[model samples]
Each structure stands twice: as C-alpha cells, then as structure tokens.
Target chain A: MSRKPVGNAPRREPIRTRWIWGVFAVLFVLLNPWYFPAGSSRLVGGVPLWAWVILAVCLALSVFLHFVCAVYWQTGDESDE
Target chain B: MNDSGVELAFAGASGITVLVAYGLLMLGVGVITWLANRGLHQSVDEYYLGGRGLGVMVLFFTFFATQYSGNTVVGYPPQAYRVGYAYLVSIPFFITIILAYLVFAPRLYTLGRRLSLVTPVDWIHHRFQSRALTTVAAILMLYALANYLLEQFVAIGQGVSGLTGGTIPYQVGVVFFIVIMVVYSWLGGMRSVAYTDTMQGIALLFGVIMLLVGSLMYFGTPGDAAAIMAANTPEKLAPPDGPGLLRWLSLLLLVGVGAAVYPHAVQRIFSARSEATLKRSFIRMAYMPFATAGVVFVVGIIGIAAFPGLDTAGSEQLVGRMASALANQSAIFYWAMVLLFGGVIAAIVSTADSVLLTFCSIVSHDLYGRFVNRDAAQSRQIMVGKLVGLVAVVVLVIIAWYPPATLYQIFVLKFELLIQVAPALMIGLYWTRMSRRATLAGMVIGAIFASALTLAGLRPLGLFNGLWGFLLNLAICVGGSLLLPPSMAEQNRARELTHV
Candidate 1:
C-alpha cells in the first residue's frame, strides 16, 4: 500500500486509490446473483445454493471493511484526543 | 399501517407495563447523564456533540440504533415474506454502508476534529464560505430529517397500539414517548441520547434473538421454508433476473451512499472522541448486519411456511401475527413478545431523538447562531434551537394525527433532495480545485431535478429517481469543476484542508 498522503489532514488515505475502489466494485458486482441461471433447481439444506453465495459475499465485504478500518484509518494526530 | 388486520395477543396490560418501564429507564439515564455532565450548557458543542467524548461502546451502539429502527423489525419481515430470499440483499446493503463510510469518513473526521464542525452544514460553510450553498444544503437536510421524524412518530403510535391492542391510544403513545424523549434530550443532549441508544440497541438485539428462537421452535427453520418455496414458489428462491439485478444494484448504491452522507451520520464522525474510537466503532458496525439483519431475514423466511396464501396486505402483518402466535404458547414467550414490542418502540424513539437533536443542532449552529442571532451566547442559541425543535415536533404530531393525502409524496421528494447533497460532500473531500460555484449549481439543479422526477413518478431507466439525480449531481460537480476552476486562494485553502 502507498504511504503517500492523498490529502493533508495529517492522515494519508491509502484507500483513496483507484485499485482499492476497483476491488470494491468487483465485490459489489459479485454480490448480485445475475450470473446464476434463473431457477437452477439447486437447493442445499433449505436455501438455494445461490443464496449462500450472496451471504458469503456479504461476509467477505464485512471482513474487508474491518481490515481497512484497522490498518488504514489512523488520523496521525492525537492533540484532539 | 396494519392493512392485514393483525392484532398481537399480549397487547393490553403486559405490553403497557413494559412500555412504561422502558420509558422510565430512558428518562432516568438522561437525568443521570445530565447531572454527570453538568457543563453541557456552556456551548453548543458540549450539548449537541456530547463534548466529543463518546467512547467506543456508546458511539457504536448509538450508530447501530440510529441506522436500524422500528421499521427494520416491524417492516422488513413483511417484505421478506413477499419476496422470499431476494430480500437477503438487505444484509449486504447494510454492510455496504460501512464501505460508503470508508470512502470519505477518514478525512472528514480529521477536518471536523481540527475545525470543530458542529453540524454537517458546518463543514459545507467552512469549506466553501458560501452562505447560499450552506443554506440550500441545510434546508434540504432539515426537511428530510423532519419528514423522517414524522414517519417515526407514525410508527411509534402504530407499534404501541398494535402491541397493546389499543389499551394505549395511538395519539397518546406518540405524545407520551415524545414527551419522555424531549425531557431526556433536554437534560443530557447527545450524551443522553447515546446512553439511551445503548439500552435501546441491547433491547432490540435481545428481543429479536428471542423472536428468532421462538420462530425456529414454532414456525420451523428457514431450510424448511425454502423447501416449501421450492415446491410451490420457486421464483422466490431463484436469483435475481436482469431487471431484479438492476433494482438490487440500485438499492445498494442508494442506501450505501445516501445513508453514509446523512447529516446525523456525518455529525457522528464529529462526535467521536478520537480517530481510534471512531475506527473501533466502525469495525464493529461492519459485522453487525449479520447479527441484526441476518437474524431478522431468517425469521422472514420462516414466515413463508407458517402462513401460506396470504395476500400482499396480509403478508405485511407476518411479524405481528408471528409474535401473537408465540405469545400464546406460554408465559415466558408472552413476556418476551411483550418486551419485543417495547424494543420496537424503543428503536423508534431512539431514532426520533437522534434526528431531533441533529435537527436542533443545525438550527442553532447554522441558522440561528450564524445568522439570526450572530452575537448571541451559545446557551441562548441552544435555547432557541430547542424551542424551535419542540415547536416542530408539535407541528409534526398534529400532522400525524391528521396526515394529508399527499404526505407520502412529500416523503419521497424530501429523500430525493437529501441524496442530491452527496456529490458536494463526498467529492469535495478529496478534490483540491472543487469550485464552489460548481458545487452550488450542482446542488441546486440536482435537488430541483430530483424533486421534479419524483413528483412525476418517473424513473427513466428502471433506476430510482434519487439515483438518477445523484448521478447528474456528480456529473455537474465534476464537469463544472473542470470547466470553471476554483480561484487560486480557494484552491490553496482546499489543498491545505484536503490532501497535499
């Protein structure tokens, strides 16, 4: 990840880059079920298999958010604190 | 709202008892917090932003309680019952809200902390130093917030009356809770609101968990419901088609961006004690959708097998009827369902209080403090804002009692205009040469265009009218910035405030 400050509030926004947003866009597309054929007749346990796929995508997005918040959200100042 | 004519079983004595207990608890917290933070009256910042001293847990729960409200519990299940698992998108939509925050929250937080922004409009005025732009954005947000509170008031009355089977009249329930809410907010301001939010969030989580457990025991598992859908209504189980995909994508964008840029949500960034406190709170919010929306999504799915062949209107009462059925099973569940109903009311009250506080803050800091009484002391400004908020609430309650036929249309237009403010807020965070004229033009035109489309009930390409307006707003903001660059001094200021 780039350590360069995107703007100067004393904090560098590494997530402001294009590739990170690209990754988010990809994950967002995967969240939709358009790729799955309509009525595939696939049911695992109780929900359709496609439904589980969507849930997994949701989980992935959340974990990614956690990673970003922990690693890249530092404000680089403590005077306010 | 209960077109299905569903009446809960434990609606009279038991429901009223829990409701009163919850109200008393919230009021007590407000008084205690007020006494502890006795210097709240010194300045607008101390009162409205809790002196920016919110820790991780209080901040986290306040964010949680504000985003998901009575509507989530009482309204979502009916949607799930109608559309089946397609409604699972609700889970991801909420998680995406965190993603939306990641886009702009870091920088916004730093700026707000450094500049001491009291409201979302404070950021706009400070950034552009333009009264025209700030007034437009504040008016739009204030209207949106007032309409939202009106909707919550209606929900409070319905939830109370539904839970009590009319033992407490609808108007009385709304007025009673509104009174309690005002007292606590008056005493402790944001601190009281966030403290009560912690209580309300816990009640909601526990109540929903019990509801889910009772549902699994009585109504059968989601898997069982899926099998029924597979046999009878396979369309409900299938993935989204072309048009469905469009709608799903639209909901994600609309909710992710619109909710993230909410004036209340933005002000929460200012309320964080430190970046670390804000970070921890956000990290927790990232996973909360699973525990809250996910559990409720399963309950809605379970409703499918339990009650079949209901019309669209009847399906809206799925949760109420399910709660009623569970209450009848035993004494334990009877109390649990009663508590669940109280939690529903608490959720609405929590939302209403936050909106009210923010509404009052904008009035005090932006309109009255900045314009009407520029030299007034902070306490005086705060008092005027409070009185105005109370008057607004009174006016809204009257509207609720005799809602106009066109009230729903007003709700849609207000929301559409609210989303139009997104372009200036998010893009202006990183863009150094963001022309204030470009932003002002974008905001004014975008709001008018969105409202016009909503009034005509037009969605040009199967997209939401709000989304269409947002896209146009962004185009104008970016394109106009390129066409008409910011003045050198404004550009220099932007670079200093934004990134290097």
Candidate 2:
C-alpha cells in the first residue's frame, strides 16, 4: 500500500479556485435575507416576490454548482500514484 | 372546512395503506440484496462497504439521505419559522460540509485506501495503537449514533401519526418502520441501504418540488406572505438584529463542523469506488441545500402568513397543515398532496434504514468483531451484528414512543462525540508526531468534557450550542500531543506509511 509523501508541503491550488470559493461565499451571504428589510415585500401572485427571487437564485446556484462539480472536479485514482 | 366523516376515514386509510406498502417494498429490496450477495456474506469488506465498489450515484444519494433526512425536513423548518431570516444560515452551513471536505479529502482518501479501514474507528486504531482510546471513541460513537437513530425513529412515529390525523398510534408507526428497516438492513447491508436511499432521495426531491408548486398555486408568493405577515405580525419579515446575527454565524460554524464528521458519513467515504467519485459526489452535494433547505425555508416563511398564530406544536406541524389544506382542494391537487405526503414518509424510512445499517456495521465490525469474537468467522460476526441491531431497534422504538425533551439534547451530543475523532483523522493524515497515547488521551478527554458540558446545559455565553466542549476537546488533542512523546518504532512506522 502506498502512503502520502511526507514533507510534500501542501501544494497550493491555483488562485482561481480560491476566487471561485470567494465568489460563492459572497453570493451565499447576500442570498440570505440579512440585507433585506424583514417582513417587507410587495405581492406578486399572492406571494412575496423577494422570497421567490431568493429561492430562484438559490436553486440556480445549486444547479450551477452541480454542473461545475460534475464537469470540473476530478478525483485521481490512488493506485496510479 | 369540516368535510363528511366518511371523507376523513378514507383519507386516513389511504395514508396508512400507502405507508405500509412503501415499507413492504423497502423490505423486498433488502431481501433481494441479501440473496444476491449471499456468497460474500463472510467477508467483512463485502458486508460493510459492498466490497468498496459503490458507484458515484449510489454513493451520492446515500450521503444525501444521511445528511438531509429527519433534521433537514422536520427540525429545520420550525427553526426557519421561529428565527425568520437568521436561520437561513442552515443552507450555507450544509454547503460548508463539502467545502470542509476539500481540506483533507486528497490525503484521507489515499490513506484510507492504503489501510483498508472499515469504520472511522479503524483509522484511529491504525494511527493510534492505544486500545483504550480506540474503545472509548468507539463507545462514544455508538452512543451518539444510537441516539441519532432514536431521533429518526421518533420522527417516523410523529410523522405518520400527524400525516394520518392520529388514526395510527405513534407506537405502531415506530414499530412498522423499525421492523422493515432492520430486515432490509440485515439482508443487503450497505448495498440494500444505498439502493433504497437512491429511491427515497428521488421521491423526496419530487415531493419537495410538488409541494413548492402547490404552495405557489395556493398561497401566491413571498410578497403575498410578507403582506399577510406584515398585517398580522411585522416582526416575522424583518432581518435579524442583535443576538440574531451572532446566532446565525454560530449556526454556520457549529453545523458545518459537526455534521462533516458523522460516522455514517465517514463510512460512506470508505465505500466510494474511487477518490474521483467521492470528490464528485461532494461537489454536487455542496449544492443540495438549495433544493432541500431552500425549499423548506420558503415553506416555513409562507407559513408565517398562511397559518399564523399556531403555537409551537401546531407550528411544528406546518408541512402537514399545508398538505392537508392542499388536499382539500381540487382532485388533481388532492392526489398530488397525498403523493407528496407519501414521499415524505419514504424519505424518513430511507434515512432510518441507512442509520440502522451503519449502527449494525459498527457493532459487527468494531465492537463484536474486534473485542468479543476476534476469531469469529466473517459470517458469524455479521450475524451477531445483525442480531444486536435488531435488539437496538426494539429498544430504540420503545424510547421513540414516549420520547423525552432531552431528545434534542441527545441529538446534539452526536456531533460533539463524532468531532472527537477529527483530530485523529486530520492530524494523523499529515503529522507523524502524533503519539498513540496522546491521541487516545485527547479523544477520551474530548468525549467526557463534551458530554459533561452538554448535560450541565453549559453553553458558551450567548452561543446556542456546546462549543465549549469542542474548545476543550481541541485543546486536549493539540496540547496532549505536544506534551507526550511518540515512540521511535511508531514514528518509523508512520514515516514508512507516508513514504509514497
């Protein structure tokens, strides 16, 4: 069985990945109702539009993240290493 | 809005029959799985991890069901209703589990492959040769997991009773699910549970979508909800202020860290066919909060306007209330509502099956296989585990019937105990200096302090959870390691192990 190399000095991933996480963090922060006036909304189809918009945004983000995960992330086989 | 007495009876019968049918089908899956893999029954690897051949989809849904079931559906909504905007942190907190996994996935996956570890306890045993520490961590995990399983069992009983208008008593509902869960889990082991989880996950997703559409058609939008809430109680719409902000941030940290270390979850990691599959599954999982948490949050917010002034118990029944209201509408809406209710039941059972399987695997693999019957054949160990699991379900079902307020207290204890293994998991992956004695000391100290603080109702000032326990747990893990010395042989072993 193979083991992780010692003193390999955790290799830093590209700054681009950090940027991606940063963007997601910020979006999540904003997507929550913390910035909006509470209990405040104009009606659209008998529901609060802002809340629906937030839900839509959240759904969109989830789908987007799923796509990215499916496409971009790769887990290399341990046997090869 | 009181319909004919006959209508009520029909609805009750329909609900109970549908739930019973679902349970029977789940049991059938378990039996079939057992027959298919009967030859492999003697191997610990095959029974616990399905020969470690679980694919991405099966692996993904299993993790999905484990994470989102009882708490996500039942526990979270009331919190959203109560706290309003602040509790939205529950969504991101879930997402954070995936983010947290990225930190150690690369190394842990490699190490897990190298060691052929079955449970997280095995990883500890491999890293730290101290049997005492290993035993303590195992006991703590078993206790926490049992409590967690009991919580799900209680939810099954409450959910059935509430959904069926109390026609079926809580005791019967608990027994029905518990028996079915045990049989299926005993037969197929992980494979049976994973297959059922995939089905349950799909059903749950469908149910949530249907409910979302139904709510939109009935109640209008968030704006409408806001108008109603504003007219009745404006406070429900306002962003959280003062302690609320602090509470939200605390929730994000507490749940994110606590949930990632769940034993069932760790076991799933070992079941993955490859590192890529695990990583891919997590990446997709990072996004699930939107469907599960976001949808549920919206439902709770809508409840603020749709059904105002419900006290705590009534509020807890928010989903059921909305479904009943929808069912009373047109024929199409009525059938759809019933399906959604059935789907919820399916989700709950799916979670119960997975938990029961994990509970059995740990007992069979760790406690019984390691201690009581070290020389027992693989088939014998599996049988012992299954028997113990059946006994556990019966006892837990009894507890579920009455259920103490301390359920939540016991529930929270799971995370604290599970997190005790984190130092070993994370540190042992990289640091060779971590002595077996020190690691053992930290786990023991962590478990005691966490349980003590929890029992004493000790919270860190304004925070909602027992972070104090964690603080001490971490301190002991890090501090004890520094104070103790690693043996020369152990050091050499660790170095050799990591020398890839």
Q: Which candidate number would show the highest TM-score if scored against the true structure?
A: 1
TM-score of each: 0.96, 0.87
The alpha-carbon deviation from the true structure for residue B388 of candidate 2, after best TM-score superposition, in angstroms, is 1.8
Error of 2 at B151 (Å): 0.8
lDDT of 2 at B420: 76
Which is the leading candidate under lDDT? 1
How far out, in Å, is residue B456 in model 2?
A: 2.1
The fraction of reference interface contacts (C-alpha pairs within 8 A across chains A and B) present in each candidate is 0.70, 0.39
Residue B386 miss distance in model 2 (angstroms): 1.2
Each model's lDDT? 0.87, 0.72
Each candidate's interface RMSD (Å, one decimal) is 4.4, 4.5
Interface RMSD of 1: 4.4
lDDT of 2 by residue, B244-281 (tens): 65666666666766677777888888888886678678
